[model samples]
Target chain A: MDSSLGGILSPRAIRDDGASMRLTRTIGLAATLMLIAVGLVFLRAEQTRLAKATLALESEWVHLRGERWALQAQVARLRTPAQTRGRMAIFGVALDPPRPASPRTPLSRLALVP
Target chain B: MNTRVDVTQRRNGTVVLVGIALLLVALAGRIVHINWTLHEKLTGIADRQQSGSTIIPHRRGLIFDARGRMVAGSRLVPDVFVDPLLVGDVDALAQDLGARLNLDPGKLADGIRARAGRRFHVVARGVDEVTAKAVREMRNPAVGLTMRSARTYPLGASMAHVLGFVGRDGVGLEGIESWHNEHLSGRDGRRRTIRDAARRALHGVEGGAVRPVDGGHIVLTIDAEIQAAAERAVENAVAQFEAESGVAVVMSPKTGEVLAMVSWPTYDPNRFGESTPQQRRNRVVTDPTEPGSTFKPFLASGALADGVLSTTELIDCGMGRRYFGRRLVKDVSPHGLMDIKGIITKSSNIGMGIIAERMGDAALYDIMRRFGFGERLGIECPGEASGIVYPLRRWTSMSAASIAMGYEVAVTPIQLAAAFSAIVNDGVYVAPRLVKRLLTSDGTVLEQRNSRPPPRRVIPSDVARYMATELLVSVVANGSGWRAALDDYQVMGKTGTAKLPFADRKGYEPGAYLSLFMGAAPARDPQVVAVVMIRRPNPSIGYYGGQVSGPAVREILRETLAYLGVPPDGTVAMTAAYRSRPGL
Candidate 1:
């Protein structure tokens, strides 16, 4: 009677069930590894995007510096004595440089608040 | 029949399963071999495909005058270049680019075709910002722009010989620019980055990257206003006299600071290529000439200092001519007997020859050396000439008399000015200073104080004061330098008219002369010493130093004194100061 009952729960059936469980575990680990790899790829792309933005800012900064220097140079050129003289000659007006304030200068003259 | 079919099917299924297992094992082995064996090679290939590098350009320093006005500066301008290998439809592209850049299309096309194998060809350098923007907006892969600093002299030719011009390679070629090139050319930097597939820099790499340090800024002691005035004065003199060239220099007696230095026939630094080499020479420090009567004060100073001649001593003028060992010493006019003061006042060559004889050659040479003649004076300029002064051992019999009358010796205008400053500065031989301070890009200030030798006492203070205040004053007051007199100030100076020597040093050139005047003003305590030198003026207009350069010196001193806020001699306080001084 006991042998007949053992025959009902066969060793082949246990082997089949164990094979199915092993397959399920293998598929689960592989999906987890795939998720981690895809996450890393997205992180790398985001990092590259940030770096590109930084590079753009750096390029803009350099350009602004160059522009600032060019403007300063232009201002300097205009301030040259030769340029001033040419302008003075062209305008036919004599422009005397304002005298620097000295100890002798009156306070009212310096204030210019008439 | 059924039993036999089942047995065959089971054997075939077993064979198929074994075959499938062998294939899977072989695929796994191949994967292992690739990952382990070819790892380093493949990784190297990937790194090379995803790496980029670029140079971070460095900025050159600026040059400013004493008033903080920009004399020489630099700006980042774009250099246009083309990649011939990458250009498409070369003729069409060249036409399009040439139309925008004002270049000839035929030449541009030829240049591109000729350089087809090369990666880069320079189309233009230092393009203006607007042109650079136009090129950038072209959006063509073949065209590119690189930033480079272009040096600009804002004051143009007015400050050319002093500030100088920079070369195409961004190196200084002359004057102060050349002397301070290393300090002006800052270090360049480099950057390494990781790139994407499109060759865009994705990230800066960790190692082998450097940041650039900017160059130090140079602040010159030149006052821009005074420099302009001096330049205008010199230009006027040159034009009025129809001279070959001219030079004017103004310096502070107390600080040895060069306030203004102008060399005429000057080339504009912005357009230096259009000028000749002669126009580019800085004659103030580079060319030496005989100073003629301008040298008499030093001779007189040496005589008085050595007790060789008294202030009241009388010497025979021999009626304007005397012979010293076959060399004839002649005066401008006949004078019978004159005191030491009369000799200087009359500018009698025979009288100076007698004084030279009394004060031997060695003593005279020593005094000239003490007065900073025949030496470089170490001013901040390139190609400075250490003027010619023969040693006592090489002195001919007539050399003493020749030197005494300002011959057989050479002195640059700067050297003469520095020597005269010794008299003006109360006997101190202070070195000429062109640079006042050097400010680094980091905001650190480096004062140029005590960089060279310290000031030395060249003569007794009393002697220098007496010479500067009394004798020189008398020269402008009652002597050859009379043209240099100013109505509002007591002008003190001497005039010189030296004949130009032949190129081979054989003899003087007829009808060619260097008219020179060196002077200081307000007389009691000298503030500024100015030297005006005019070369090869029209003899018809007048080549005398007192007539030509004296008036120029008078103009310069007048403007310089007024600019410096020095009170006029007519002021009661100024007159009292002159009266209270012991030496005067």
Candidate 2:
């Protein structure tokens, strides 16, 4: 009975068991915190890249819209009849009347109706 | 032994410390150098991204008439290019493109093969809208299209001279385009993008764009309808008289604004290269010819203004000719004794010489100068001539006689028109201008051009009125300009048939004459002044200004008055029926 009590209260045994428990808990907490920090850093870098791309696209879009407006205005101004006639006159060209059809007799016109 | 061991340990420790210090210093220097180099490279990249890669082409401005109708403008077109290196099956590709684009398959294959290593080659230029659409839909990876603006003359040949033509790169070559090139050419912008090493667009760099500025619009003072009428008149006269060339100008007497200026043999701006340089000349402003009898009115005006001659004063024009110092000044018909009004009406050289002698050369020259002769009309055209008006000191006795009869003096059609305007416009000489106003892109007037201030009174109001009234009688009575008389309007005009000077100085060409007619309508209060010149008309047509060119002027004036809704003068019938009646 005395030997049994001595084994149960052994100092080496108690020391070894306490040391294993402390080491395991420290390793587990350290690994979890490291993973959380890495994930947050990756997410932040991706958001920054997307914001930069979006800004560049918006600027390009604005520039294109301005060019479109200028082209539209030019087209609208070019397609008009009065302006066309004025330009032709500068070249000293005059418009001519359409050619008249040949005269047909009344009897010939009636025969064609049949 | 113990001391030796301790000393060796201390020496080793010192060596280790020195090596670590040297390594740290080398590392710091390399790091600083790399950081500075990176900063410089980044700055260079930013600058290149902002300025390089894409180019912006300048666009030509639009030209519009007074009614805001477009005459000349720019239209967007596509330019096609091919990447020769990327093209596969050259023959097959060439055949397909040739059939669709109307190109020779062999030529396409040769061109593509010659530029084998090149990334791009121009396959076609100025493609039509339909062809451009087809090209875009082709979806061929090797082909690319870039949009560019091209100059278009919508009115074709009508507005050619006024609107002018542009080169392939859209630079104005003549007319108003050449005159106002700087204002019409807009600034180009650029779009810079970040590109990979292969020159493929990666992404648009931050702040890498410059917007293009559009050219300002030009509004002409000419009314399109009036211009068309004037053009028709000139064209008809040119064709009818078989004249080598002709010109007509209509101007507002009050403001000297050119409403219609026409020149025959003018080329279509749309096809300028197809015509000859002689046809391209703006004869109204560029070519100067002898004033012929049209100059008689000015001589008459000067004499009347100086009180040297009265309308009723009789002058002797014995027979049909008179000898003045070995020079013969001939009259169209023999006049025993004629009044001042009769001398102008008959266009008598002998009678005019007698009047010119009383006025003296200095007085006549001064009057001509004051009327804007021997000077440019200050028009907007580029190549305007200053008509020849020699100084009185350069004149001989014969020079005075010849100048009085519309000889030895040269004047442009425009100058003649302007001078006639002064005669009818209360004697105020104003410079002629084609540009009425210059506007910004958004219809804001940048500058409003006003008529030039009158330099000096060449004639008094009464004398101007008297001369104008007499000219009106000449148009209706037995004057040469009988055909120019309007049916229901009081036509005031003068007829001039002056001999053209030969290059050989053989006095003057006998049959070769420049027929001219200058007049204003509604005699009492003139609104418009027209001058017409027909050069080298068929002698068989009896090349008289009153006969050949007068009818054209009448038609133009009638149409112009009707178009402007001017009411007809009821007094025309009485004026037309009234005979010379000696003094009446």
Candidate 3:
């Protein structure tokens, strides 16, 4: 028993409550879908960034390994007998003179079981 | 008028509806066509444009000695490039690079200016680590550095012939490198990735990824110390005799493990371009020459094993000369009468010729084959030459006499050494092996599960012992191999002074001789066999093997035995000979 102004066209008819409810539900569903799509895109981008970072780290480690091998090659070249003879002073500083096999007699030390 | 208006309106509405309906049908047809036909093609085109892949490079393997020292290695240097347009402060960058790389800054600037429109211009290759680090630290957007590998021979010319050089594109070109290339250079992997608008890899799967496997490692049986001694000895012999070329081998008689193998005219693999083609050849395993009297011991072994000659039976050498058919063969020295043992000890050609003719061609050739002649020994070396022995059909009247005295047949140095190793190993022949083991990148040892050869009997143990004691021992004691005797060790050996063919492969090359000495140590129970061959030594300094290659063998055996810790079995006599007569 609500009051009305017009004879046939009243405020209750103008409201159209069912249609409004339907429009609100459709908008809410569409907005939720849009949020989910944006979240998936961001997740993809983050994954790419992390993958690139990991590859960069691995490449650095590979580089370090390569450098270590190169340095070792150089050291081997420097330690050859001919090189040692040429640069005796340099190796003499790092290496001690020959240690005596034992404090006892030389023949005893030379005597092996073979 | 009202009725006419109604009919016109109806016609107009019908026409408009029909047109609208047709347009709607066309739009639906177009949508279906796009979904069914064009979708796959457009998607394929997009994928081709957006995704890419590249090979992940793997480093080549290294060669190591038995003691785990690096003989051949690879260094990962940088291949530096630059984007000429994007490079800023060109003068400053050029100066910095020039200082680091030892180049002229002015020339570098001019080179960069020439590559005006190029995105990538290679500035330097094989840039060392320190320079590469300095360039990277500059952080210039234009400067790009990619890793490249260059081979390195740490010991230079030490084992250059064995550990060969690599080619321009990082493939093995020679020596052990080429033989074990598949094992040395592992399979390269690939990285398939998608890129964004800025062309950065998203690291996603387009197809799939394969993990790269690094090359397997190789360990040789050669000891670095013993190899050095052998190399020095050969160098000294070549210098002393002024020989054209020389080869030397130190092998363990028991296992046929080659301790040291050396060839003169060796080239450093690092600077492979500086040497001539002649210097690059590994004559030890590749070159076969006519083995003169060194072939006599095999003949004696054959004669005894076939029961054609008794150990005590005497053959008259008759002043060192013997005639067969029309050819007169002469020995190095004169011997009147000798047993089979005496013939070997004296290296008498006539005695050997008579015994060999009695044995005939088939018996001699069968014995030769049993001793591993004219066939490749499969020593894991590249370019091994299978020696030449004429077949039965090719034999002439002089063939038996020639073959009997160690001529008409050519043999490689390694073949002769291994043959004598059988005599030293108590009549059992084991083919020589150079590669000790193979290891994976992760330290897993790979066994040669297939390539091992079984030991074979050549002569009986009694005949071999007699040969080692009577024939070989006497050679060192008083024969042509007298100079090869060591003071502390019991030396047993033979000598060969062979005439070489002319360069045209015709008759003998006058004044050219191949002086060779083949011997084993601790003659009573031989442990090691050393063979030295000096090609075309100067006649002025004496071209006899006992003189030319003997001293070198002496020094080499002394060093190798000491390194192996072989105790002196003849010390009492050795002390009298060498210990300065300490009590005198």
Q: What TM-score would every model get versus the actual structure? A: 0.85, 0.77, 0.79
Clashing pairs in 2: A87-B158, A87-B159, A88-B157, A88-B158, A88-B159, A89-B158, A90-B158, B293-B496
Question: Which model is ahead, 1 or 3, in terms of DockQ?
Answer: 1
For each candidate, the alpha-carbon lDDT, in order, equals: 0.84, 0.76, 0.81
Q: For each prediction, how big is the interface RMSD?
A: 3.6, 10.0, 5.1
lDDT of 1 by residue, B149-170 (tens): 7788878788899988889887
Superposed by TM-score, candidate 2 places the C-alpha of residue B352 at a distance from the truth, in angstroms, of: 0.8
If you assessed candidate 3 against the hidden native complex, which CAPRI class would it receive?
acceptable
Q: Whose lDDT is greatest here?
A: 1
| lDDT-sorted candidate list, best first | 1, 3, 2
User: Candidate 3's residue-wise lDDT over B50-99, tens digit each?
Assistant: 66453455668888876788888877668888768667778988998788
Model 2 alpha-carbon miss at residue B380, Å = 0.3
lDDT of 1 by residue, A24-111 (tens): 6557767877999999999988887787776677667667877877787888888877787789989996744443344345687868
lDDT per residue for candidate 2 within B416-521, as digits (tens), equals: 9998988887777777777777777666888787776544466888888878876545654558888888776788898888777787876777788888888788
Q: Give candidate 1 regions above 4 Å deviation.
A: A1-31, A83-114, B1-52, B88-92, B104-118, B193-203, B206-209, B571-584
In Å, residue B403's CA in model 3 sits off its true spot by 2.0
Docking class of 2: incorrect
